[model samples]
Target: MENLPKKVRSKKLSTRVDLTAMVSVSFLLIIFFMVTIELAKPKAIDFNLPDNEWTYRGTHISCGPDVTRIVTILLDDNNKIITYSGLLFTPIVDPKVLNYGKNGIRQELFDRRKNITEYSTAIGKPKNGPIVIIKPSKKSNFKNLVDILDEMAIANIDTYAIVSDFTPEESKLLALK
Candidate 1:
């Protein structure tokens, strides 16, 4: 019997994977996210806060601008906004309930601002915009405050204040309305 040469068996090779590419890609992804986060920082609303005196005085006292230039806005519950010119005690423009939107508080603000500006110019007073006082009642929500703030910005009002405290008389007036 002829002995056949033993067939040579091929050596089994273990699969080897290079992790350098994966590690580099992961590092690139992390760096990309970090750069994006650094570039896209959260935006904040710019506020011009009053001094301690005004804070202590609250909305009851007339400390800010003159009565002629002042416009008070009260934010109540149920998306109701009450606006009037000057102090609540002696209002230049009678208090009227207003809603939110272009036609509601926004229109009133625009008209008031324009009228105030014209009046100031006619009276030879310095051409200054109306001073808006935003008073959010206890029943009011945050959205009301934000909407009023947006109105203030849209109206291009320079002088404005957000007073948390409401006078007793003001509260009564709100209840009546």
Candidate 2:
């Protein structure tokens, strides 16, 4: 008998998948989400405390400028704002009694800011504008203080200070209304 040649069959293999592209896309998506979300900024009220050492060159300590363009605001217990401008020694103009609203303190602040800017420019001292001194009386609540601060910011005031002292005259004014 003659030897017959047997046919050999080739074994089939499964398709191999390349996961490199999918992994790169997934990593890119994660990075994109991380960059898009914004973080919240902390809000705070700015306050300055007096230094413990109160002597300047063997004399009483004094701070800030002694100028005419100063606005003093006294916040009273009844949610009333009593405001006066110029030096304390200078004769006080009638204290303006204002409420907290768009047409109240905000309007007054805007008008005062405008007048101060104009006055400074006319006198050739453009940098010498108004400075607001906020004195919140013990009678006043926390909300009142916050409102005045918000008004200052809305009116675009650049210079302001929170002082705790209240002159006797200011105390009397608060007593009026």
Candidate lDDT (C-alpha), each? 0.82, 0.76
After superposition, candidate 2 runs with Cα above 4 Å error:
1-66, 89-92
The per-prediction tally of clashing pairs is 0, 0
TM per model? 0.64, 0.62
lDDT score, candidate 2: 0.76
* Per-residue C-alpha lDDT of model 2 across residues 37-134, encoded as one tens digit per residue: 53334557664332232222236445644244568889988898988777555633446899998998888888778887786677566765567899
RMSD of each: 6.9, 7.2
Sliding window of 10 residues with minimal summed lDDT for model 2: 48-57
Residue-wise C-alpha lDDT for candidate 1, range 32-86, written one tens digit per residue: 9999998899876665543222211235344554566778898999999999997
Which 10 successive residues of model 1 have the least lDDT summed? 49-58
Q: List the residue pairs that clash in candidate 2.
A: none
Top-scoring candidate (lDDT): 1
